[model samples]
Target: MNRRVKEGTYKGKKFNAICHFFGYQARGSLPSKFDCDYAYVLGHVCYHILAAGLNGYMATITNLRNPVNKWRCGAAPITAMMTVRRWSQNPGTASIGKPAIHPATVDLKGKAYELLRQNATKFLLDDIYRNPGPLQFDGPGADSKAVTLCVEDQDYMGRIKKLQEYLDKIRTIVKPGCSQEVLKAALSVMASVTEVLSVMSSSPINGQSSL
Candidate 1:
């Protein structure tokens, strides 16, 4: 999605013109020099991640990333997955909300997808590995070393880490907690994080403020 967005009308026209005259360089024809180096050698990754038993996931032909076929898999939440959108108003039972979980899903609970979800990371290089802080200029700085820090850098990332931990804590405190200290901590976390984000809400362009 980021690549597509970056390649606007002008970029699209350039690629189309080049292909129209000389054809894609991958087809053994090119105009000048083209360096198409991608991280993670596509050789072995494609074979297994695109192997049997996952046909619908492989959408390579449509210029779509990650073929949605047999072997490879990507995932969204069950709540997000539960959304089966209607196309042309042709549905028997229009299910809009999350459906009741079935037995088959429960059987596949401990699989790689679930395990992958539980595996947390503190750095990232790609969208698959990292969300990259929501396209930046809009939120707290990324915690990754690779990402350059912005305004209030230390205070921002610090508050963000605390916010994430606090949210996780909220998930575990379902047993009617009367601990005022914990309650206050959660509220303080919210206030502090919001303050950082609010200041960062203005995009800094070459160290100049956006009036």
Candidate 2:
């Protein structure tokens, strides 16, 4: 049997397989809590993306680590996330490839990596694995987010909201009845902010020129 397997004589059928080992961790876990909620929210976002007529755009949900209500649904151009790749197929021969979106991977220098490193010792020797058994439909565990997301500190939507609030506050402070000095200061600040934003908006991303 070992010789037959080693000599490539064991072929009967060939098929691709996808392992769902972790997906089966929960009892009766065909559709786990997080998977169900995330998929449903993405479907909702897709509807809005289509309604907005953003062709060739990706549906994005920022502030994922927050509650579902706080999630911001929007669409971004798929091209914006793409980059051109130049590769060498053979010695001294180069090929320029079309723009493509790269898959995301764990950043070794990121906070998520730090968190894993911090827990490495405990994970290796303490025999302290956590199994959040069964999907929870309500209460505590239902609102939990992935550890990586929680540590990444990527609350873009939240930051956007804060910026909007600051803008509104500035407008209120520099209203029509304000002093001349205050008005001038505000105008100068606004001019600088606009200039900066214009440059940033026009800048190329990932070696692709903006359209």
Candidate 3:
């Protein structure tokens, strides 16, 4: 073990810099309902992923807002989630950096963030805190989901499947024998949709969108 070279005020210390220990603050022992349930389900998913001999894959559980029985489990390749970054020392010059997985950041524009921002001051200053006690596995609060999950319609894969269903329906409805009005309406709507999607598609390029 290394000892302090000289204990008096240390070397090159900033006059205004300070540090504080946070171990005692926010140290309630109870786990939240969402954390308990999410971990339990993901544990099972991880076991199945292992039993299937998957390598370089991350276990996933979706539809957290739904009942536990309704949740979907799957595994995704680690490579598919990585982003290849480009490093540039100068504005017009660049070099390729290694691919890495970046943690998902909260969207400041998202509804959950907006809700938290609106209540943040009150939450900090008001004596309105309520403890949820220990995590519940069966009764009242057991099925509770995260605030973000409740605020955002985050059934992503479910929405994708629904979109595919709609596309299939459209295909069936817009065949050669369809009415002229039906064809015209589909053509108009699809043209507008395609134009908007094309504009969005052209505006981005870094790596695959985060799941």
The TM-score values for the models, in the order shown, are: 0.24, 0.62, 0.66
- Sort order, TM-score high to low: 3, 2, 1
Per-candidate total of colliding backbone pairs: 15, 0, 0
Residue-wise C-alpha lDDT for candidate 3, range 1-211, written one tens digit per residue: 0134256545653447469987877685666767777888889889998899989998887777777777777888897766656566888886657666855887899999999999999989987534345566677767666678878877767887899999999999999999999999999999999999987654424543322
Top candidate when judged by TM-score against the true structure? 3
lDDT of 2 by residue, 1-211 (tens): 5567679997755546786676446655456566787789889888987887769987788877777777777777788776665555788886656666754667899999998898998878887634456666777666656787787878776788899999999988999799999999999999999999998777755554444
Task: Write down the lDDT that model 1 would get.
Answer: 0.40
Q: lDDT for model 2, on a 0 to 1 scale?
A: 0.76
For TM-score, candidate 1 versus 3, the one ahead is 3
lDDT of candidate 1 over 1-211, digit per residue (tens): 4477577634433342233554555577322111121112333445655564444332211111211232232322343222222233456765343233222333234444454455435224334634423333224432222221111123333455687897787768723565878778777977998899878655433333333
Q: Residue 170 lDDT in model 2?
A: 95
Evaluated at residue 63, the lDDT of candidate 3 is 78
**In model 1, where do residues sit more than 4 Å from their true spots?**
1-166, 174-176, 207-211
